[model samples]
Target: MRRFTRNAAVAAAAAVAALGLTVTQASATSLDTWTVTPGGSFTATATNPTLTVPAATLECASSSASGTLDTGSGNPGAGIGTITTLSFTDCSVIGIDFDVTTAGSMPLNVNGVSSVANAVDGSITNIDAHVEGTACSADFTGQVTGYYKNDTKQLVINDGNLTASNADCLGVINDDDPALYEAVYAVSGGHTITLD
Candidate 1:
């Protein structure tokens, strides 16, 4: 009887996977494939983007990023695209002007499609951001989780995945402090990216 039950469970799991279902952390309802329409190079902008850590908050009046995606149908895998440039303008940390930039790794991925129509979940990996202020400074590195909507053309991020490293901020922002980058970027450019 034990052997029979175990084999049945394995068969059930295999059946689910054969349906092209992405039953990972994303969502059980999310399909395992993605379709990017009119894909290519694109640019995005966000207003009032903010990065909050246990020690301090870095807020910006505006932020901009540019990247590209493949044009056509494909599976949601790593390295879907790349964010070549990302910058934050008119930023301040604790009321002090700060210069913030994203560097190192920049890959866009589509990990899952939410049950909701036109919504896709993914992340930007290897995110390295340096914050420099007159009285505070720190470097954070990690990935940012976000969901992109086709109708709104927005990528929303509000997760604490970045870890502070090489801290030198006079205790304003310490090392190993988890940082949350929250923003809603209105994506636009040559490609009208859409998922199917």
Candidate 2:
């Protein structure tokens, strides 16, 4: 009876080890590599994009962005891609029609990707935009937080760490005033990217 009990215990330990091994193997599909399937270049268009400062705010009806991401494999770190161009259209700043330009701030860094189900959390850093209106001008620069959902292929720019400076309009945007930039971009050309 003692011999039989010992054999049963040994078999149980083996079974547990095998199950652990199987689980480890199945979990190997982590975000180890990222691929930009159809193409590397992608274009994104936004709806209801807006930029707000303390004094003035611009509510844009339409916006668009274009950028490229490199094919990174095996534990991708920061700087995997960059946003080459960003444009805002049909914007009104304090009742004055205007447009926002990110001049000299092109190629914004695409920092890193966080693990999420069917989606990747993306952070777009180094945001700098120049807003000019009928009688006002300001410069906004800072980083913004956003996430790219794989299911909808939408990159939503919501909360941001932005600041305003060099205000000439009046007193709406002061030097070092906190700012917020918001937009929802639908990405295209780079179909269904996987960041894992």
Over the stretch 64-174, how does candidate 2's per-residue lDDT look in tens digits?
A: 888877654443435556788888889997678886899643433333454556666566777888888777778888788777777788888888688888878777667
Which candidate tops TM-score? 1
Model 1 Cα lDDT, one tens digit per residue, 1-196? 9999999999998998865454463554244455677778889999999989887788999999988887777545467688999989999987889999777649987776656566777888988888888867788898999788888888888664899988888988899999899999999853434444
TM values, all candidates? 0.80, 0.73
Give me the overall lDDT of model 1. 0.80
Total clashing pairs in model 1: 0
**lDDT of the candidates, in the order given:** 0.80, 0.73
The parts of candidate 1 lying over 4 Å away from their true place are: 1-31, 115-117, 190-196
Q: Whole-model lDDT, candidate 2?
A: 0.73
